[model samples]
Target: MHHLFMVTLKTEQSKRKQAFFWINAMAPLTSVILGSILVYMTHAEKHGVQVIGHLKKGLNPPSVSELGFGSPYLMTAIKAGATIGIISLAEGVAVGRSFAMYKNYHIDGNKEMIAFGMMNLVGSLTSCYLTTGPFSRTAVNFNAGCKTAASNIVMATAVMMTLLFLTPLFHYTPLVVLASIIIAAMLGLIDYGGIIHLWTIDKFDFFVSISAFLGVVFGSVEIGLIIAVTISMLRLLLTLSRPRTYALGNIPNSITYRSIEQYPAAANVPGMLILRIDAPIYFANTSYLRERISRWIYEEEDRLKSAGETSLHYVILDMSAVSSIDASGIHMLEEVRKNVDRRGLQLALANPGSEVMKKLDKSKMIEKIGEEWMYLTVAEAVGACNFMLHSCKSTSAALTNPAAVEPNTYDYV
Candidate 1:
């Protein structure tokens, strides 16, 4: 009854919302009263149905002195605290974000973190339970139509009153009734659309989600979190170790170049190969890039041979996307240069950033690669290659005069 009342209120008249809200609000209390009466009237407690027996009517006592800061198990406590704290923090922030996105609202993450941190800090002294917002509680409050932080104030006040004077009222309340209410609230939070969307867009994310769900269902929250994190890290490392590269081609009647696979109409310049790296050049991906570049060269040669087109002469690397390079990257480039030289091809670099330029200069690669071969953009690189090969009709003529080249200059099969 606490879960679906919001939908009922939405369907009613605007003026009737206020009246229906009170009735919806009374459902839980009514259930508690009725369940307690039933349990009492039927003597269910004596028949093994558990109930919240007795009452403790008082304010919290000081537990500061009970804290064993200097105990021998302090290190163990710290380790456990750190692990649980991290998992709780991540879960709390994630829940806040999920609800905020669902309701089309914004929340300041830093403010939320600080507020939860302060709550936990003060709570520790008073022997209060750890205070990160749990998803089940958030779902219940969300279904109850809580609009702002004021709901927390109301909750705190009600809890205080319950501790002081209303303790005896719940003494005969059946625990099963409360559990059922919580389960119903949680059921409303399971988003079927999100799961299907993830499955359609990204299979890996869907698999990870399933793994976490299974872990939590069969084991515990910690187990689920660890499995999700491990799979995520593995994916990250895999992508970093083998970053993707693309073959760029000129767009007809335009100076811009883009991936040929993406733009099927883009034209490939004869006698030259253009490639772009989509990640930083580092030790992790350098070796894979070397083999991949070699394969591209061989493949280009085979295609040109089959077409009886202009023999491959130049290899231009569009380095605008490659932001940085390390020692292994420099070595990989040196090896690539040697390989290109052995194939009787000239190697050219286009749009190397400041970081890459500095590393290349320090490694004496700038002098070896020749400053004259380096161009500011891929168009200029292609123009130079075309001019050298004396096939200036498509690329070089297009750069010198926009209208000199024909549309669909040179399409790759």
Candidate 2:
């Protein structure tokens, strides 16, 4: 009925379409009320129709002393409370941010979390159980054209009025009717199109989504939430553990460097190798990164050997994307430097961020690797390495053939 009403309203040729839209939007609530009234008038309760019995009148009284802080169950309570709290917080923030994105607005996640935490604290003080922004309620609120948080205020005011003056009216509200309203609201949250889109775009994401859905349907909500969170964490760990490394090559007629795999036009520098690590340096990826760097060096050497060209000498690590480093990461870099030195090649760093510099300085790695070998940019590092390489070659040539003109060190300078 809700869908049908939307379809009709969409085609309505009326200047007061907004008024009609509001009326159409209220149809679900109206159906619940009128259905309850009809059941009450006809004495449907006599026919085994379930209705809400007497509800306690008035607002919730203070229960400041009712909170449990006892011995045997205190730890259990805390664990359970924390798990549910985190799940609720994640769901609420995800829903809120998703809607904010759809509406093209910014949502400060930290601010939202703080606001939710304060609300939960107040609720606990007043004897309320855990509450979260359920997707169904959020969808209905959005459908009802709520433009601001003021809608929440309006809803709270209505709830207070109901508690104070309209409690008796709910006595005849059938449970089945309430269930129907919930089912109607929840139908909008199915989002089959989203599932289809996910399947088309990323099968792994689709698998996660389907797994969560099946877990909830077959087991429990908590089980489903656990499965979803576990899969998400695993994905993050996998990405970090096997982070992508690229062989950077210089673009033609530009100082810019880019991945050769990504840009086929980018050309490798003669007698030099450049690599870009695309993730922060941490313990988990240090070993993998070390091995990957070695592989890149071996492949470059093989390519040079096959083509009868000069072997690699200067290995420049473009650390522009490396945001942070740990002790393990520093150790890995030391090992790499030793390996490069064993191969009679120099290791150079390009564009290390402040954090990386600080850590390296504290570990005395900067001094060990030579401060002069580090540069502000990859281009500068490559130029300096090239100049030094030419100087060496010219000195060697002068020794071999004194008649050969002196290698022009002035041109490099």
Candidate 3:
């Protein structure tokens, strides 16, 4: 009895899923089926210019070629219609995902795809190409107290009744009016405000949007989607290449060390640079990291040369922020160690995670840099390097203090 009850529950769940799928697919299937039949009929009539057409056309003339019939223009019209429909559905589903977040509802993407597929399958059989979820109609339903799929039944019933009884009434509706509706729908997709907003937020995003817009307007819609996706991926790689680095220090009355640029009152590690890498070390960004470190080394060398001094002494790499490492990164680290040693500067690594440490160990970097150079904490690393713990004097005093800071005439000039 228990097993039978559980089996029955599973069957009910499966039926509900099927029901929801049908609900989502029905509207697009019906709309496209009807629209296609109308197109086929109008083409058969081959009505060139009626009294109603002349009345609809103002003093400003419009194109009189009706493409609903079997012509070269008819194929182009159908192609354009399919393109617009697919784009509308893509944009609609994205909006639905956003609203689903606020409404605390879960959307099954695979099920939605099945529904969408069925819509196209049924629509094509009825002399249509393809149709998709209409954003405007869905939004209207959402606003008008549509709680369940039952609302669609009422809506479909009304539409069917209208089609059966009021066919003659729609004959008086001008061709120009229908054309205007199609044009309006297409125009809605050209999101000028969205483009502007993307530009304001990120210059890279602006470039991407511009590329996509131009591709769509000047080239083809298919080409535009391809260009947009490609550009997005390239932008992601570029971002990873220049991961943000910060000089971290302890905030007053707080144990947590934050970026000195963020908190002015934070205690800095004088005579020692505490640098934090804000990303995983990988082949893509290895050269970028090297360049940044090289810049700092060059600046330090120039200061030392003017003061008749030797070195900045120590650089503490705070690796607590690093979550992972790759083979290219290991090679980069070895090169950095060699370069720093050749320059008579000490390079110490602090707080490498277990995974990173294991990689470092496998790479045999710990012994090359010395086990003493590896510390669990930044403070311990600084102490091992024989750097001062606290700043007794202010930064102004340190700048003027001969013992703390060597005089560099070249820096002043």
Candidate 4:
């Protein structure tokens, strides 16, 4: 009831009317008090009602001496603390940002983390558990319509009063009432709409959500964390190992070339296969790329043969997007060059960047492919291939000058 506010309560508060507003605000307190009184009157503890039992009145004794820094279990304690701390930080910040977005407010993440760290450090000395802005209590506070953090000060004062004077009153309070309050607060956080939206948008994300949720409910929070992390890493590795490749074609009336699949009007040049790699070349994807390139060449040849088009003559690789390459990538290039030569097709490289040129220089690959075969741009490579094709008289006239094809100049290291 405290979570719900009536519209009438907001309008013009007189002395008596304002006094009545406190009733809605203190509904949880009323419930606790009535539950405690009823339990006490019925002597429910004797009937196994599981009351709160004795309450300690006073302050926390310093537990600094219990640090056990020199104990043999120090390493284990450190490991446990580090694990729980990581999970706590992840969950707290995630929930905090959600509420911050919902409320349309801003918060400094670094300050929030620093405050939590200081609180936990100080709290540990006073025998308190590790502190975090957990979702349960956060949801409860949000539902109560807290306008500002000053509510925490009021709550702290009330708690202090309870500890100093009202300890005996809660001794008969049933644990069920407290649990019910927490459960009610947590019910607002289920977010079924979010789960359904995830399923509609992305199956993988939905799978991750369900896996984490079920793991936490059945196994443990740590197990859920492990599952989520494992699935995410697997997805990352799969994407890297099979990075996208595009069959490029020239955009009409322009020197620009783009993916044939992406640009429907882009026309494919006869007797040539132009391909683009959309990711960096690395050891993880080297083998996959080798097979993928071979497959592209094979598929292009098959498509040409089926259509009775000009025989596949040249294989042009657009290296504009390949930012980096390792030794394995260099080897893959060599293997691809050899395969193209074996298939009686001329292989040309175009627009490889400074880093790729440097790697090629280091591997003595520029000398093998030669300066005449490498071009400053894919369009220039296509021009050289078209000159070699002997299909168009006007294109032949355009490429009559040898300097028409600009080759990349690389200084070997």
Best by TM-score: 1
Error of 1 at 168 (Å): 1.9
lDDT of candidate 3 over 275-342, digit per residue (tens): 88888899999999988877766765676668766446677788987899999998989988888888
Q: lDDT, candidate 4, residue 1? A: 38
TM-score of 1: 0.84
Instruction: Score each candidate by Cα lDDT.
Output: 0.84, 0.84, 0.66, 0.82
TM-score of every candidate:
0.84, 0.83, 0.56, 0.77
Pairs in steric clash, model 3: none
Q: Give candidate 1 misplaced runs (Cα > 4 Å).
A: 1-25, 391-413
RMSD of 1: 7.9
> For residue 68, what is the lDDT in candidate 1?
77
Candidate 2 has its poorest 10 consecutive residues by lDDT at 6-15
In model 2, what is the error at residue 311, expressed in angstroms? 1.8
lDDT of 3 at 176: 38
What's the CA RMSD for each of the models? 7.9, 4.7, 16.1, 8.1
Task: Give one clash count per candidate, in the order shown.
Answer: 0, 0, 0, 0
Instruction: Write candidate 4's Cα lDDT for 120-149 as tens digits.
Output: 999999988789887667866764456698
Q: Write the per-residue lDDT of candidate 1 for residues 1-413, one digit (tens) a residue.
A: 43235333432332256655555455555667888999989999999989999989966887888987789999999999998888888778877987898789998889888988999999988868889978777876775667798999998999899999999988889987776555655655667898999999999999998998788668865677689889999998899889888899999999999999999999888888999988899999999999999999999999999999988999999999899999999999999999999999999999999999999999999999999988999999998887878853556777988765545646543
